[model samples]
Target: MTSQDERRAFWEERLAADWTETGVGYRALGRSFNEWMYRVRREVFLDRVGALDVDWTRARVLDVGSGTGFYVRAWQQLGAASITGSDLTEAAVARLRDHFPALRFERLDVAEPGDTFAGADFDAVSCMDVLFHITDDDRYTAAVESVARLVRPGGYFVFSENFLHRPAQRGVNQVNRPIGWITARLDRAGFDVVHRSPFLVLMNAQVDAGTLWRKAWGGVLRAATLTEPTGWLAGAALYPLERRLVRSRTESPTTEIMICRRR
Candidate 1:
C-alpha cells in the first residue's frame, strides 16, 4: 500500500478505536506514565519554543500533521489569533471538529508539501512528532522546504525532528543527527537557526510504545533514573543508553531542539 493509504489506515484504526471528541485529551487518555510523558514533553517543548506567553492570542498558527489537534487547544489557550490544523486523516479531523467548533481543519497527505499551506501563510507554524514517519529523503526535504515556503518572511518555523543520529535508525523518525547537520539542513531549507540544544530525553520508546505491563516496569525504571546522581550512574552502567541520555549533560545528548526563523 502507499504512504497515504498507510496514514489513512492509521487514523481509521484510531477513529474506529480511540478518537474522542470531548474536552482536551491527548492521543492517550488514561492517567498513566504514558499520558504524563506526553504532557511533560509538550510542556518542555512549548517552553523551549518560548511560545507560552499570552501574547499569542489570536495569532494565526498552523499545525501541520495535527493529529487530534493536541496542540490546537494549547495555541488557543495561549491566545492564538487562530489555529489552522491540517492532517491526512479524515477521522482525526472529524474528531477535532466535534471537539473544537471554532478551529479550522483541512485534509492532506503530509508526505506531500503542496497539498496544504498554499501560500506564505500565518505568523508561526509547527509540526510535532510528524516528520520521522516520512522515510523518503527527497520527499522529506521537499516537505521541509514547503513548510519554510508557507511561513511569512521573518516568521518563525517552530518545529522539531527526531534526528537520525544512528544510521540504522534512519527508517524510523529522523532522530539521529547532530545539531550541526540539522542546522545545515535548515539552512538549505531557508531557515535561520537562532537557538538549539544538544538533546532532551523526550520519551522511552519501550515505554510509550510498550504494553501496559512493560510501561509499568519502564515507569519504575524511569523513576529510578530521575533520582539525582544515581540516575547518572545507572545510565553509565547501562549499555547503549541513548534512550535515557537525551540531552543530558552528564551523558551524551540524545534528542535536540532547534529554533529557526525564515531566512
Candidate 2:
C-alpha cells in the first residue's frame, strides 16, 4: 500500500479500537488531562468561530473528520439548524450515529475524489485537527480542495492545525507542515483567512520535552498512568496559565484555530 493508504488504515484501526481519547492521541496524557484538553480546545474553536458573527440558529453545519462527534454535540447545543458529521472510519461513524441519531453522518475520505456528501454544501465546515494528517503533498491538496468544495460561497471553514514548521514525528506519522504552506493551499482552494488563535500555548509535546516542570509532571503521570481520572485536575490547573500565555503571544503558535471564508 501507499503511504497515504497506510495512514488511512492506521487511523481506521486506531479509532476502531478506542474512539475516544485514543482516536485523537490524547490517551497517553492520562484521562483527566485528555478530557481537559478536549474541552479547552473545543472552547477555543468555538470562541474563534463565534467572532465571525454567523447566525448559528440558521446555519447548516458540516464537520469533516468528525471523529467521535464532539463538535457535533457542541453545534447542537449552540442550536444550529442542521448538523452533519463525516468521518473516515466506520467505527467513528457508527459511534456518532449511535450517540446522535438525529444528526446526519457520513463516511468520508477528504483525500479521495468525488462528492462524499452528494454535492451538498454548508454554511460552515469544521475540519479541526485533521488536515495535518494528510501528509503527502498531492493528497493534502486534494483534501483541502474537497473540504473547500463542501463550503458554500462566502461561508466559513474553521480548523485547527499545528503551525510548528520543524520536522517532527508524532506517533506513527511524520506530519508537520509550515503555516505559510497551509494558508497558500487554502487560498488556492478559494478561502481567505479571517482570524487565528492559539490553543495549548505553554503545554505541548515540544514544551513537555524540554521544560523542567512539564517533564516532571509527565514523569509523575507516566508513573501513575492508570489513574486517568486525576489527569483532568492537572489539566484544569494548567488551563488558565495556558490561556493567559497564549493571549499574550503575537507570533505563530505551535497549534492554532484558523477561521477562513470561502470566496
Candidate 3:
C-alpha cells in the first residue's frame, strides 16, 4: 500500500486502541501533561479567537481533526449556532458521536478527493495540531486547498503548527514545515493570515529549534512524565510559566496558532 494510505490505516488503529484526549495528544507526556497542554490551548484559543469580536452565537462552525472533541467543546462554549465535528478516523467519529449525541460527527480525510461535505458551509474551521501530521507533501498541499474550499469567502480558518524557522523537519507522522512555505501556501489558497502567536513555548516538542539544550530539556521532561504523579507535578510547575510565555511571546520554539481569513 502507499505510504499515505498507510498513514490513514495507522491513525485508524491508533485512535481505535486509545481514543482518549491524551491518546490524541502527546501520549508520552502522560495524561496530566496532555491535560495541562489542553488547558493552555483553551486559554489561548479563547483569548485569540474571542478578540475577533465575531458574532459566534449566530455562526456555524466546523472543527477538523476533532480528536476527543476538544475544539467542539470550545466552539460550543463560544455559543456557536451550530457545530459539526470531523475527523480522519472512524474511531474518533464513532466515539464523538457517543459522547455528543446531540451534535454531528463525520469521518473526513481532508487530503483525499471526494471526501468533504457541501462546499463553503462553515463560518469558521478549526484544525488544531493536525495539518503537520499530513507528512506527504502532495497531501499536505491538497489539505490546505481543501480547507480553503471548505470555508466561505470572508470566513476564518484557525490552526496551530510549529512553523519552523529553518528547513522542514520530518518525523514518522509529522512535519514541521517552514513558516515561509506555509504562508505561501495559504496565500495561494486565497487566505490572509491576520494574526499568529505562540500557543506553547516550552511545554511541548521543540522540533523547530534543533538545539542541544532544548533536546536535553525535552528528554528530562519526557523521562519525568513516565509516571502519573511526576507528570502532574511537572505539568503543574510548567503550567504557569508556559501560560506566561504563550501570553507574552509573539513567536515560539514549539507550536503557534494562526488566525486566517479567506479573502
Candidate 4:
C-alpha cells in the first residue's frame, strides 16, 4: 500500500480501538478541560452560524468525519430536520449507526468522491477536527474540494483546523499549515470565510509548554487523587478567562474555528 493508505489505515485502527483518548477530556486530568472546550466550541459554532437565523428545526445537516457522533448529537440537540454523519472509518460508522439508528451514517473518505449524502447537497456542513489528518498534499486539496462540493451555494461550512503563521508538525500524523494557505485553498474551492477564532489557546499553551504552573497544579490534583473533580473545577474557573483571551487575539491560534459560505 502507499504511504497515504498506510496513514489512513493507522487512523482507522486507532479510532476503532478508542477515539476518546485522542482528546484531553478522556484523560484522567482532562475532565474540566474537555467540558470547557466543548461548551465554548458549541457556543462559537452557534454564534458564527447565526443559529437564530437558520431554522434548524427544518434544515438538512451533514457532519463529515463524525467520529464518536459528538457533532451529530449536537445537531440533533439543535432540532435539525434531518441529520447525517459520514466518516472515513467503518468502525466509527458502525458504532455511530448502532448508537444513533434513527440518524443515517455512512463510511466516506473526503479525499475521494462517492455518493456522499446520496448526491443531495446540504444546508450546513460541519467538518471539525478532521482535516489536519489529511496529511497528503493532493489528498488534502481533494478533500477540501470534495467538502466544498457538498455545500449548496450560499450554504454554511463550519470546521476547525490547526493554523499557524508557519507550517508545523505535531507528532507524525498532524500537519499544521499556515492560515493563509488554508484560506487560499478554501477560496479556490469557492468558499468565502465569514468568521474565524481560536478554539483552545490557553490549554494548548499549557499542554505544549508543560509550564511549571500547570505541572504543579496537576501534580497537586493527581497527588491528592482529585484529578477529575479538581480538573473540572479548574476548567470552570478558567473558561471565562480563556474565552475572552481567545476572542481578543487572532494570531497563531493552536486551532481555528472557521465559518464559511459556499460562493
Off by over 4 Å in 2: 165-171, 207-230, 251-253
Candidate 3, 26-99: lDDT as tens digits: 87898888888889999999889888858999998899999888889999888889999999888899999999
TM-score of 2: 0.87
Local error of candidate 4 at residue 262 (angstroms): 0.8
lDDT of 2 by residue, 163-233 (tens): 65544434446476767777889999999998876765644454213357656755765554456656656
lDDT of 4 by residue, 1-263 (tens): 13666766876887777755234132455545566667776666665555436788878988998888878877877888989898888888888899998989888888885765557788889998888777777788898898888888888888988766655454466677767888889999999998787766654433222358657655654543356676677668767977787767764235678888899
Best by TM-score: 3
- Alpha carbon lDDT of each predicted model: 0.58, 0.75, 0.88, 0.73
State in Å the error of residue 142, model 4. Answer: 0.4
Model 2 has an lDDT value of: 0.75
Q: Is candidate 1 or candidate 4 better by lDDT?
A: 4
Better of 1 and 2 by lDDT: 2
lDDT of 3 at 208: 73
TM-score of each: 0.70, 0.87, 0.96, 0.81
Off by more than 4 A, model 4? 19-32, 168-171, 205-230, 250-252
Winner of 3 and 4 under TM-score: 3
- The backbone clash count of each candidate, in order, is 21, 4, 0, 0
